[model samples]
Target: MEIIPKLDDRLKDSLYIQLYRYFKHEIEQFTFETGMRLPSIRYLADRLNVSNTTVQMAYQQLLAEGYIESRARSGYFIAELDSDFIESTVTPCTKLSSEDSSEQKEKHILYDFFMSDIDTDHFPLASWRKYANKLLNSEHKDVLKYGEYQGELGLRKALSDYLHRSRGVHCTPEQVVIASGTQSILHILYQLIRWKNKRLAMEDPGYQGVRRSLQGQDIKLVPIPVEKDGLSIREFKKVQADAVYITPSHQYPLGMVMPIAKRIQLLAWANEQESWIIEDDYDGEFRYRGKPIPSLQGIDEHSRVIYIGTFSKSLMPAIRVSYMVLPPALLETYKHLEWGQTASRLHQQTLTLFIENGEWEQHIRKMRTLYKKKQAVLLETIKSVMGEHVHVSGQNAGLHIVLHVKSNCPADTLIACAEKAGIKVYGTSSYLNQNKTSCSLPILLGFGGLSLNDIKQGIKLLHKAWLPYYKSSEQCSVTP
Candidate 1:
């Protein structure tokens, strides 16, 4: 029997991914029994009206993930899977009630433009696996033991060197603290800084995850408005904040790179007030417009900046590696505290090797190029498809751009319409701390996880979905 996948070109996922999912589903459901031979790449390509390379990629993915195996001079065959694994992995089908069915239909999103997503298809799996396997050897058994409370020394050293070379950050290996994620690092930072008044000023309409994290600690969060350049310094001075959190490299959700003049002024304020600046430089590696902006911590003459960087965007998020550079003041405080290691010692060791061998920088350059192209495609597609129906902002940097939809409907209504059309777009309303009505119907479209074709198709579908509500500025007033 021949296996055929029903591939839809209009869907967000590429043809190879769709084909892989189809086969994986079939195999999990036992439709493709153990030892059953799959159709040849050429045969399947011709039958499915896709390229042979696409079929080969799908088969390779299945083989790598252990869904199938290939014999020399023979076609692919289904791999024998453990019964318990299958039972746990596959959800049992159940007849849904009317309400459940409606809910499921509403949640069915074909294309997702999540701001935090990254391109997993382009991850350096082979390079990562090589280093991981090397660290798993008997000679490297020390990696399996409990690591330092601060983090792996080797990784910290590697990161210190990298930050200095790329972002102009000034820090020693002793100041570097590795954690599982940015939130984990933030929690630790809070502990170190909790001795002071717990008032922290953050960007208004900023990253909600960080806002929620700080709020959970009962820290007073003052929302400073973000202007066309970045955080408004004039408003920030009004609040008696103990510390300020800002994404200066590329502001989260808004994608504004804070100007150098503002950066100097903020640092001056921190120095004069004896306050701290928590700079979360997430996705600082993918600037598309002009020369790459040096980090906020780079310009700190007073050492008031606590710099945080993560590999979740540059590499895949599953790696779960984020590091922060503590100021000498905070570093001393952190040393006195009792905290266990959060990141995996083994994974940290592997990453250290990956970086030391120069693969980390190499990977960044490759991804920077790839993301630039994806961003360009997304912008061109929006202009061609959406035209004057939307006004795009935050386009020159980061993985996402903001689209202020010229429609009378609210952001939620536009999101619902897009959802109904099987497209997923995010809103900026949740980013605001209090002023929900301040923002217009602005939608965020992330291009990092999407293919070039997916971006085009998604924008076209979005235009068609919101066509009914499209109105001119003269006809209806909409604030961006």
Candidate 2:
């Protein structure tokens, strides 16, 4: 109950205020915590070397403020804690959002498999630290103020340079609008184009996160199936979608690089249909083989394509600096919508340093090397363990790949088996629409974060878990 009040700087008038502040800080810092009784007025006075009146006045002030509350007979205590406060502060991951009770409702545990996580182990912490310090120590006022909605000029310029040299994306900094990520940028796009009928054509088994971003928006999505060739452009001729979203460089779920012909075909179709194309160029920087295919935006002579790039896949997902190379036609719309309302310069400054100082390239080179090795090891393990029982696809460029399960077992069953083994794998049914149940059971597996040794062990666990199904298949094959 001893409240030590340091009253060295306190006088008569300000003493009460000072005392209140000191105690308030103590309560917050856990010197006096929730449900803990504070010292009486007499004890506080003796400890702080202040008068009884000053201590009493401060206590009264504390009670008046929301920092503390008086328990009528016993004394004052901190107010009852909010039961849901701890859970409320959980960090926003891809699925977790700020909403009503609906947000916390128990979704099926399979929801975890559907999650694509950034491999934190591979993040360039040293470079990030250098850039963060550079941003914070800079003398720029815009870094601290409400910054350009288009994003910091330096960052936009840096990104422009990067897109040109690395990914072959075409456009100046003015056409680029920095958003939190592709998801946030898509939201802005959703807002800008809501007046149109807004039927979006998305790739079948495409990036589900994109679909989720357009959730509850005015847009309607038409799912187009992906094939060995790439996004089935022939199918787009049937659907009357105004906008088509794609992962051109590395097609999602099936990792086939869209050849120059397909890319040209898609652009031509979009032009004829007057449809906009969103080229989500995620993980394009980590090419394991061959010369970098030019971006759809780079080849986009008609200005029908929007190029989206992110540091999330290369850097960690938490570093939300994704930019888009807009066509000239959309520049005014982007400027009008984002000006005085969106993006912060601090984020721009931070990412700008990462890009301009050559650290971004160095980091990308290192991760690309590491991820390539991981992919090789994962493939080796899968081949050795799972063998011809499953089919693998889309491990060519991105961090994740998909495996199609045999007709002997369903995808949900395999997913359930994986969870039981403490290994997570996603079933492709979620990516597919209503017709998913009849299709081959595709399991989306992320191998980027796992080490070669972990990948080996994980495959071992997976094989052991699937032994029952393997045995049943073997027994059924016997001529009994």
Candidate 3:
């Protein structure tokens, strides 16, 4: 059958892609019947006044997508697709407006307080570019090759030294398994321990990213309550979990550091139970009050802790470099399993150079100072503008703070109001696995990415948006 696709040169889409879409739509509509022969690439190219490569590329795409099949001598023919398959692949034209509207709404947002955002303006771009370019030279073309299974050796060695000096983490280069991000590292750890560790206990209001990752692995998750000092050691002692995940350096959302006594107690419990502990020290470098607490792995003599660290907060999130220090037993298991590296080799080399040149520590020092100032401004503005109506916590460490708003409105309602007024705030309810109803309304506002002026103005705007629901102490008594 002759196939003629109307090609447009003025449109943004290339001629091949447009032609591919046209043939795809026609095949889905059954305009091209099952087993019907498509026009030859040369004939179609000549008829459509396009190059043979364009027609060949379009046919190749269709063939790859199962819409067409190519025979050795029969050229291309429409595949026999079922009705259900065709219906599922069809896209309705009505979705365009909703997608466009969503994009427009995002454009209107003046301030976004995303918890994962880092201060991109302060990133050491020049230094990073210098290192990246150095690696891109002809002499360093070996970066294009596959990296070590555990990760690049030099990067792991650098990470080990940096972790020891900065966080007091005890490990050698061999124990470090670098991956693309925290979730990927967690997935690898789960594979190594899944046979023995069937039940995992996590904090009640913990990092949901880890929770979701574990949930997918078919392991039962037990939510232990988080106390003022961190995860409740008393409650943790009662559970028969094979492993426990904790953010002890600075508790997530609540912003409370785990005391040294509790850390030792928790370590003793793990030692006694012969269980494992996964310590995620995310954003451990930034501490505004008192001296920084040593990492849990530093104090553990039992070798039961799996220490996870990331450069996303310290340097820049775009680098996508995160590593985990595995205990000797897990490292043995990982060696037997033989997994390929997931992180980019080029990035790994660049990071290695950045650390070796003493730039990584230097950058962290700069960022910590800058973030301290931003957090101070954020806290001051919240107090001055919201006054007695808002109670803030999770300060002095990390990029974000949690606000317990004293109002009749729920956390979701407050977030919606903030968005409508061109500000973005996050809700904390999703982080809790249980006991959500007993807690007060908590909103998370990150000040890392926002400017000092934007921080003050955003809080003022948020207060104005929430003014209608704000009540005096006597009128509302919501406990945080």
Candidate 4:
């Protein structure tokens, strides 16, 4: 059968992705049975009125993802995915009770404000390819062998220098341990500290990923309330915690940068209580305000802080590289632990070259400018359209900003309404560790993956979606 997929040029998703999704959905639904032959690329391109190259690209992606396979003389065939396996691995979407087909119509989201996504358009692909090729061309024995368990020495040295200069972190190459990502690094650190029975303090409306990882390790988590400044140190003192996890540079989801005074106070607490502070400076490099804030680790003179940094936000997430700066005390513990190499030596070598040659710095500078403009547009559009009906925060840094909706509607209701209008906004309640908070119902709007035009249009559509609720409130005020 000839497959004719609907294609939209206005959408942010590329044609290849759209076609891939169509074929995948069809296969999943069993419309295309296993071993069914797919149409030739040129034939499908003609049927769908798309380019032959686009069809080939989509097919290649499907083949790579194991959704389809190719044989000699045959174009492509659907892979045999076991029904039981699919049912077990694939999560089912929550079905709506209402008879309205609105939920069905809301299948495609044109503007996705997903937080933690970086703009793939701005990534230094050309520079990265050049560096990767250069490293592969050289007959260096280092790339072929297993790197040091902690990571490549050259990459760690380069990272140490960059961290000291950019983030004001003081550390040597010996203190850095590179891992796959934040979760992996945290796993190693948790094992080294052995703080299982001890309570670990975290922000109330904090990063869910961090909280989940700690909980999985059987660590007792104490949720501390966060204010406009940062996490409440007063609440922290009340708990008998041995270690605390904080995103001091730019608080996740809420976007509060801890001031120097607060940083000093936290350090003093760590010193006095003989506790350790886990500082996650995830996106500290993208501060749009005056100067990037100095890292909390930089101020801890007592060596009571364990600094964690990731390249997921700054570079592409696919790189999967993160590093932790261990204090002198724990550095020995890490050395004795049975740990194997986590990050690929090839990637580590390329990253080291990228940093040593200053390309990484250049990329950061360029992205900072681009993200600042996108953020400004998102804020300006929201203020102009929503007016005082919404309160925006966390615009100082990072990829996302929080919108405190001033309506009586629940956070999920607003999110659903926006979804119906083809805009995706995330609820903040799920991020709360203790489910109870006095803060207004907030929704996170991420602009890192969107363009300036899309940001403006998305905010406008959101305002339109929420207009009726505020309009009714205004009408009631005048009538009463």
Q: Model 1, range 1-480, lDDT digits (tens) per residue?
A: 856566899999999999999898667645566899999999889988899999999999999988999999998999998755564554322223565346536655778888888988888899998998888865856777899999999999999999999999999999999999998888888888873447888998888867756665767888999998999999999988889999988887888888888999999999999999999998888888877778889889899999999989888788899999998887777998868988988889899999999998999999989999998898898898877778888987788998988766677767766765678899888888885742264788998999888888888878766655666546545544
Tell me the spans in candidate 4 whose CA falls farther than 4 Å from its real position: 1-106, 436-439, 471-480
Q: After superposition, how far is residue 207 of candidate 3 from its true place, in Å?
A: 1.1
Candidate 3's TM-score: 0.77
lDDT, candidates in the order shown: 0.84, 0.72, 0.83, 0.83
What TM-score fits each model? 0.77, 0.72, 0.77, 0.77
Sliding window of 10 residues with minimal summed lDDT for model 1: 87-96
Error of 1 at 354 (Å): 0.8
Find the 10 residues in a row with the least total lDDT in model 2.
87-96
lDDT of 4: 0.83
Native-to-model Cα distance after best TM-score fit, residue 87 in candidate 1, in Å? 49
Local lDDT at 393 for model 1: 88
Candidate 2: list runs displaced more than 4 Å.
1-115, 339-344, 471-480
lDDT of 2 by residue, 242-331 (tens): 888899788876778888999998889878877789999988987787667889988878989988988778877766778788888887
- Runs off by more than 4 Å, candidate 3: 1-107, 195-197, 435-439, 476-479
Estimate, for each residue in 218-333, the C-alpha lDDT of model 3 and write its tens digit. Answer: 68888899887889888988888888999998787777888899999889988998989999998999888977889999999999999999988888778888999999988888
